[model samples]
Target: MLKSGFGPKALLSFACLMAPLSALAQDATSSSPATNEVIGLRANLSPADVRGPLNYEPTKGPLESFFPDCSVDKQMASELSEAFGEALISFDPENKEVRFGVAYKGLSGNAIMAHFHDGAPGVNGPVLQTICGHPPPTSAIGVSATAVMGDKCPVGNHGVLSGTWQLTDHDCPEGSDKSCISRTVDEQVQLLACGNLYVNIHTCLNQPGEVAGQITPVNWIGKEQNCNALPPKSSQ
Candidate 1:
């Protein structure tokens, strides 16, 4: 799997398996650059962008006011919760691009696909790129065919769900989507240029739309005004 869906326990277990970072740092000081690139979970928030404690803002539709507890952090092994979260999107300052990720667990079913839709943080938008496309599950509601970014849509569905049906230049073809290569680290930097891209997870139950909060840039590490003021949910 390109990315594993893990929870807090998995995060803790992985943390325990790795040597202390400090010890690793000492070992790296003597190694070549190829053996010592910086690595770990991080967000691109600035020192002042956040206000109160760390907070999440879901700006689009019914999710506007949704907020994740401030306690969630890189310590939790990728986002392993059902709430909205933030990450420091480090990218080329010149390009204004960065890759931001939002993870959600406990959706009605397995996450069959995910995307980085093109829209402002709080506003509605279209799917611009496919982030993850899992193979169909054998069980009921289990996904069968998955479409990746820049590929053709499956034989029968243009979208798993529908509403405004906002679409972008990169949506899959009418049908017959293809496998997607996970985004590369450098590509992550390129994807963040607009400072408006958000990460969304899609499950089999809500095929055409997101089942959780919309991913947005936090600018910093602290909380901001709540997003509970957006419009009512849209009807597809």
Candidate 2:
């Protein structure tokens, strides 16, 4: 037998009381809007952060093989640690559009390509987005019209990586290797919010990757010499 207190009126009141609490819980769990702006400061990325026994040579497949490494080429990454770079990324969770502006210099060799990967600061992850130096055909697979991956990069040791990455899915594509992975826009945003995404710039000398930086969300205000800002000219 149902108790009197469990009547429709009492049940309705109980539900009414819980509704507000449920709404409050949802409000607490929702992400803040300010989390959309992400930044990264890279300095001489090292293989110590990579995970694998591939001997610094990518072994994914035909696609990854395009990024070939020479056993005899000078491993400039060993000293490129002195190199510096930074990236400003704007991510819109609603549209899954990612815009990136990056400046890197002092690389040991020419900037071959750049990408965004999934990994922690001290770990290595698969490349989910290509920022530049991609072939024209494959570049359009998940690229945006605002920028072209095949566009020429800056001439010299300094290179600027600018492009848009339209994440498709997080699943690993067939015929691809660990170096490359697929991620949907939602997964990308979640990773950005979790601070698990990083940008990597690969060079001819260090095909494995020369300079890499972990992407983080932050406010650029009150930050001096930020974004790899050059030091002021010394007094003559």
Candidate 3:
């Protein structure tokens, strides 16, 4: 005789359980037609062409006091003759990310901090993001000549002369005012495109800003490209 729990009702229940399993197996083996949803869609509709490597030269003139009492001295400014450096910004609008590599030498004192500040040319503004050198736990300097890139600060001992910053994490200023930071990567991209962003390096000698440079694009001919001269890209 058939088992007590293995009668018609049990067979029906087993069949029911196997139906979905069979369907799942068919689905696992079958190939569906590819969808065309994103096949021809352009990643960035804006023709601003702001996505590329940018160059900057940090000097003394862009320095501005963040504190009322700590102004950069003219004599100290004159002494930054050997304290020159270059910064490179690589922006990826589609990915909503930015990569920065900055290097400097011959600072008046130990490097303390570096940042990308939001401000117009020749004007001082609040720190929009810290690139490196917020010490105690974190090193005040990064490795010299070594390049790092990512959405966060690189791991391990970075020298005091060079470093990188990724815009994905720690891309905002340390303040209550939301206005001090860009709300979106697109906005930051716009700020960069319009020449509204700059890099600042702070030292123990000059807490405000020791060396600063307005970030700007470099053309194919190795010349600075003025963002204002380019016509606005057609809105998407």
Candidate 4:
């Protein structure tokens, strides 16, 4: 990744590194570029992409201290597994913030929380930021994470969450306990451009996630993003 205020040589290298970035797209993605005018990332949440975190069995910390497992009944599991959702993300270079919105339906229970996690396509990273930031006592109120944040998201089998993640002294958005990927907003945008960010929706039935999707840049979105917030090439 190009560091802030990098020189021309670094810019060239950054361009080269981005040449094959479309390789990041999964087979499910479209071969066609988006027809509309837009630059951002999109995630298609589904159960097939759902993966439980790596768990090692052996004497260690309390076994109870674990992520919610697939303990939902088979019938409900089948239905919830069919749940799907989407998350849209983009960055504002001027303000140094990440703007995102999430909508999902068919959850077995009300969403407990929703977060932006960092990791490779099939890997699991800790919560990078909380787009809908809610936890424990607050989440236990049985409302959607959006509602906990004072947003007007309807509850039940469907829900929506939206917020801006801006650079601040705190690791995460205020009121969240999740670990942040970076305190710098630029780094967070870099993560999105690199397809390292994902949205995960949590429910009491699926504590880790009821549905989730890897955030992928739309068309040349990532490749074209001036994440370094640099001036135009002509100006340089």
Candidate 5:
């Protein structure tokens, strides 16, 4: 059976109705510029803020570990809760490094092992750096010093830690009882430089690990070159 009385007029009306919806969809997608997906590391040591020494409060200063190009001015410390604070970072494709800044508050205890962890932001991944470690003088003070791991320095308590940190995939989880499982320091730094890891600070009470958070990157927009320069929305 062939029926054709409706004719071309009906088809013309249907085409017109569909045209606006298609054009609107195309315009929406075209209007917004897509942002590149950035890969990097960050940490929010909230729990550590309220757990440090009662008198040893965190001071605002320039942080270097998160990035070589950026200065951390808002780095905070605490020992009461696991939410110590956060760091803001930016990637420098030219120099193959990350620029960052931080501010911390509320420190209550002795600084323990701080390092970088590798994982997608906001997710619990793996270790990446040894910001603080035990070598040589195993005492609390000795290990806190900035000493390299060796027979003389031997992982100990008496040591120093440097705020300027570069993380690697191998430096993470800290060499096991058998052997270091992750990558090398250089590799970790390269990873961090390429935005593949985050920074985290730990305390003595929680030896193996403590509270942790993911590092996030934001666009640079300040002359002071500190965490304060970060956009207000960048902060968590």
Candidate 6:
């Protein structure tokens, strides 16, 4: 006793017709390319200059307990108390590039070398990458160095260092081989994500490592978010 236009077969056909439309709507709501897309670069623009509105991710870690008595170099451990610092790293997986900023203080002597090492917390490992400020005797406590994606030296202070290193770069510790280091950018990224990579700053006193920090993934700051931005004018 159903209407001619609304029989069971007609209802079944109508439901079938609407299934794809419902799925299409759900797909549209769930997909967000902006979040997944890697940050792109404009011609002649440096990675640091390619601000967000683009996908930007940041990772950070702490540097502390770096002493000869710890896991680094006991022979060169200094009596100047413990040194400490923090490391901020950004990676562009699409371009196979990395950017880093490190700030440290309370070293026993002049800063000589700073490097990114492949190791776990409290475990000694090989140097995977050399950051700028090499050849030692760079700066003392309160040191800051930055590294960009294409400069000659990957380390600087108060500014971006203009260099890059590939995942395949054979820049390991003096006696180590590729097998001793993170062999690929993705591998390094995974290490960073899991807090396996660390920053080691060498000092004149402790030629090996005066201080170290394990790199850990952190919340991303928007490209336009001014780290130093003054608080919005007090709307008194």
The TM-score between candidate 5 and the true structure equals 0.39
Residue 211, model 6, lDDT: 62
- What ranges in model 1 sit over 4 Å off? 1-88, 94-101, 134-195, 212-236
Q: For each candidate, give its TM-score against the true structure.
A: 0.35, 0.56, 0.45, 0.57, 0.39, 0.46
How big is the positional error of residue 64 in model 3, measured in Å on the Cα after superposition? 21
Worst 10 residues of 6 by lDDT: 49-58
Q: CA lDDT of each candidate?
A: 0.31, 0.49, 0.39, 0.51, 0.33, 0.40
The digit string of per-residue lDDT tens for model 5 on 120-198 reads 3443333333344432121111112231221121122212222233222233232232222355544433444334455
- At residue 142, candidate 4 shows an lDDT of 20
User: Per-residue CA lDDT of candidate 3, range 16-47, in tens?
Assistant: 43344334323423322132111010011111
Error of 4 at 73 (Å): 12
Model 6 residue runs over 4 Å out of place are 1-78, 133-166, 169-179, 219-236
Which ranking of candidates, highest TM-score first? Answer: 4, 2, 6, 3, 5, 1
> For model 4, how many clashes?
0
Residue 130, candidate 3: C-alpha displacement in angstroms = 0.9
lDDT of 2 by residue, 87-184 (tens): 55555445565655566667776666666766655666665655656432332122222223553334456645554565556565454533444555
**Model 5: residues >4 Å from true position, as ranges?**
1-44, 48-83, 121-125, 135-196, 209-211, 219-236
lDDT of 1 at 212: 32
Task: Note the residue pairs that clash in candidate 2.
Answer: 44-81, 169-182, 169-183, 169-184, 170-182, 170-183
C-alpha lDDT of residue 236 in model 5: 14
lDDT of 6 by residue, 109-198 (tens): 544456676665555555566664433221212211232221122221112222244344333344332334324454554554455556
Better of 1 and 6 by TM-score: 6
Location of the lowest summed lDDT over 10 successive residues in candidate 3:
36-45
